[model samples]
Target: MPCCRLLWRPQRPNEDFRMNKQDLSEDTEVVLLLCGRFGGEKQEPHQPLSPREYSELAKWLNACNLRPSDLMTDAGRDALSSLQVARLESKRVEFLLGRGTAMALALERWARGGLWVISRGDMDYPKRLKRQLKHAAPPLLYGAGDKTLLEKGGLAIIGSRDASESALSYTRSIAARCAHEGLAVVSGGARGVDAAAMQGATEAGGYCIGVLANDLLKTSVNRQNRIGLQEGCLVLVSPFFPEAGFSAGNAMGRNRYIYTLADQALVIDSALRSGGTWEGAVENLKNGWVPLYVRTPGEGPGNVALVADGGLPFTLTADSTDSLVDLFASRPVDDVQSGSDIVETQQLLLVPEAMVTAEAVTAEIPSEPVQEKSQPLVSPEALASSPAPQPATATEVLAPSEAHASGDAVGTVEEPAMAEQPAQLLSCLSLDMYADFSAKLASLLGGGALSEEDIATQLCIEKSQAKAWLKRASEAGLVDKLKKPVRYALGRQGSLC
Candidate 1:
């Protein structure tokens, strides 16, 4: 088989055997070869193997006790076939041959670039991501600079690409304070808030990890960034091709890496309706990946909304780094694990379906149901027991003499029924005056699912008010309450409103 032939390749007399093995295992050369070849890099809107696919493949490899290089063997093909992953038969031989042709060039480029590649199986891969994201963690991480920096958890400073000067300044100040307390600052290495945070940490002579979405090669060698790299205080990493340009999807995908690598996350600024910053913050909140914080007296509606949603308010003047550190220390680490375990269990249950064609798997999943906002604002049971209202066309006013002559039944109505009329009347009133507030609430919910506490923080309203509005909207069929911890999402009518 192919594995036997590769094992017999002539080796140089002076070549170090340990170095050769290290190159194979630590650099993920075999997996990279497979990925470059039959993994379909030429496909439009290129993407690497999805987290689910990687997890499935990993499970198969473990079950068979085979290394990535073994995949070139006949036995490997047999093993892969047994797993019944979709499209395996059509691509097996081509994938193996492609790996053979690309392996040399890939190794050369990686060596020349001074890059280190970690696959999911590698010991040095970030355990935090695997623990938090589980099957959703990236299969490979391409990095430059010190790899050990990834293990040192720190604060993640995230915000908008167009953050205000005041927000940027606050990010810098907080990052520097984190540095003084011997903490690293993690960021996406984009412009605005990301840049400010990284610069602050490095300038303070502290470590930082820049999780870049693109331009990893260029950013690693920049004159400004080079000093920190040389000092072994900055590490730049990416899951995308080193030379690839920025992509909206990639930018969003990398946000999770930033949040996962850190113990906590701080949002400096975010737009109200939508933005990467807002989306990432909301996602982190839902996923419970880390402790989320938003700056107090925020720069925009998004920040305020996030704070209202349950994000802790972070005030630079009022809060000190030591206190922040103490707060983090006091929190139970197991709380995070508990949240991740529930999500992981849900994902694990879907692995079998995920092994089928992607399209088929997606087709099997049902969409979330939406509630209408114009519907009755009371329960069906209450509506059933209540009296029917007069028709709109019955506009003629009845005289008391006519009512008595006709033996009107109006006087027979009970006082209790009259008392219930006002509530029903109020429920029927037009909510147009609160349209702006409803729209803003919908925008926050639409960004991503949130809990009631999150809604309260995001709207800067009392918990009771937030609950009342949510209940009213829900009764009007405007939002949905998802699973445990009770996340909220915009219903169809709410999204339109």
Candidate 2:
């Protein structure tokens, strides 16, 4: 028997809502009072509540003697005892029955588990977000990618939606560099700079995550960024449910998420008082986030102001790539200024440092006999063109016999040359002690002898440095470093040993 056969048709609104239409303004006042009790404390009248009318609901909740715990079901007491339960239901009815009915569909998707929420007070919430947790903080967040990305350190790069071509190229280059050095990237998933950054990370074979203001499935208004999301190279996240539409307030609300998801913020381009990227970076700075400002030679006063006010300035030129790589090598675990702070954490992973060995690194000199081309004597024309040295004074000039004796006294150029050769060798030798040591070890090892410990003992260098140099030589195709007691030998397919 189908239970639906006995379904009672819902009465039309005009029939059931027959109560006197007294000043409905009074009903709104009552609703406002109820909102005040449920929401905590008084809210300024000018700052209206969210669609649910939680603004003044705190007063009504207190008047009703309701606590958050009251919402939980106990052995006997059930959800009906909860003011929150009643308010949520009533608000749902009001919205569904009124002009803003579309939001209910979004709420339905959320309730159906297609969405999950992170509240401001939730422990899983990002601590950095707490700084913006005042009235501006989003009440809840929804996400799709690794939620942990929100709590960990990452870099944020942003710029104008109408970004110039050069700006996009610069953003990609910097983002790729940052990602190659193992930093995560966070951005608003906007069309220009943000899309370029996310694309750059993907191209660099690095992970990049996107934060969106609207639903994951919906295309961003600037559809260029949408293609990246579709390609699976980027992760799209949003705070609103799948059915929610894009709105200005919703876009503004995502500003905090952009800043909170990153430890450092980079603004590639933005005007003074720029609503999107610049404002987010400004908010991040106030809350102690490190800001990286990128500027062209003449990007103008806004970038200058940011640089003057403690933002680290960087030029988006090819020459700065090495410096950029060094910047990205940093882990967010330490303060940006003191590179030493990272050493403690880094020391846990021990890899030998390469030692520059004398033999392996040296460029080979030609072994075959050298041939010399005969030099022509200075032409009479050339000699005539050259300026003659000033004639020596009578005291400066030596007698003919005296000049011959003086020439002999001046000594052989070959003698001086011979004297300088050993010193040059010694100086070259001094530059790379470890390399020289490794060559000796390689000779011993290639002869099918000598343990790494033996080489270390003979070389008078640390075991690690010895092994490192030997390994480096091997890597450079100079020698073979075998496992177990780690011995080094000249490579079988050798270079000019």
Candidate 3:
């Protein structure tokens, strides 16, 4: 079933629900206890755990074979008092978890305002954030509107809040083009370029996902957003308090969400050296989260330098807006950044306690053109990219000592291997180098059949990468491709039952 079900839809006033602790999932409630500030316009009574601190706590809990929900139980509470975890102070941990009253009151208010909260442990939490950001994924998310829209990948259009008229016009046109192509527009929902892009898409009857830094409660009831919410074309989410005011730190921190949530991002405008737009674009380029595209011809002061820093340049105008889809078609894999989840644990669960340490990884597959391969499973060739180059004439070399033992002539030789091979081939790296990367993948599948998204989240790789590897493995008879729901498992295991 789709995770975002309509629990309620009032014909008038639009008050959605009343989610008390009993109605909340155990993981969700625990996450709220650890990270939520839960109140409108009230001073924070206690410090919440930051991402790093939460990660440490998670690891410690995992080591103890305890889930976060376990901490809420009487026996689990008793165990916590007897246990000693250096990363988590007993008093602080207890204090945070004791905020059930505050959490309950806050949840009641949020639910009444047509708002909903999801924890990282919730199956509905945005997979892009967890897959791309890994442990840095926020522990909790507060949202309004159709949460389903969060997973619909689209073009993220970003720029300065005070962008020029030409830039704003182009941003709107490009966003409208995206809508025409049935794409969602992702943005920070701030004024200027963010607002302009969302406006263009909405006006064109397109979907959008907004990652707000603050004021989620107010936005939930904004008349302009009502139609979009009713039609399930928009979802506004925040990592901060719903009624919280905006701050510079919050704005900058939320920039990563805008980039990771999209398949591609366009820098409509940005100044050189500083500003949230510039920093976010620069960080995204360095992190390789997605292909960062900057506006050309109408390049901002920092646009040229952004391109120099690995941002792709594309020209988008009223005349060229139709090329939006073509622009997103190319996502080159460049550098591997840590936050990009180049390697990590099996992230099948949003509950940090359920996460396991990833097996050490030595493989780094480059995203390159594939040549014709012999195996034909899904199609005519293994990778099915480019035509392979002509192989050079074979050369002869002396046989190994094992051949001598087999009564072969001492000077007997064998032919050399093919001279030309596709860069995408693991053999190009070394014979059986696929083992380097395939171990974790095969291990994950060893349990049972799983879909592409599951495998990607488990192996902490991009969904595209997971799909490519699964296809190759299936062709090689290393994995069994199953029908019905579309899943995979190690074929060598002979299709479990």
Per residue, candidate 3 scores C-alpha lDDT tens digits across 168-282 of 6677788778899998999887656777787778767899888887677777666557667778988888898887765556767888999999988988756544567777887
| Candidate 1 ranges beyond 4 A from true positions | 4-22, 36-40, 43-48, 81-83, 90-97, 318-322, 330-497
User: Which runs of model 3 end up more than 4 angstroms from their true locations?
Assistant: 1-17, 20-22, 40-45, 82-87, 335-497
Q: What is the lDDT of residue 296 in candidate 2?
A: 32
Candidate 2 lDDT, 69-184, residue by residue in tens:
23221411333334354234434423222321222233233433323344544565566666645434444455443455566557887665555555566677777787777777
Worst 10 residues of 2 by lDDT: 393-402
Model 1 lDDT tens row, 1-497: 45522532233223453221345562265555444322235662333445566567666677789876667667776776566665434255335434443445444455455566777678888898889888778777887778789988899988754554555667777877888888899988765677767766765678898887766655654555556666789887777666555566676678889999999988876654356676677778777788887665454445544554446655555245456677667665433333234233222222121232212110101111121111111113311322431111100110111001224343322112111111111111233434435656745654667789988898888898888877876664345556555766654211100
- The 0-to-1 C-alpha lDDT of every candidate, in the order given, reads 0.57, 0.43, 0.62
Pick the lDDT winner.
3
For residue 488, what is the lDDT in candidate 2? Answer: 50
RMSD of 2: 28.8
RMSD, every candidate, angstroms: 20.8, 28.8, 23.3
- Give the C-alpha lDDT of model 3: 0.62
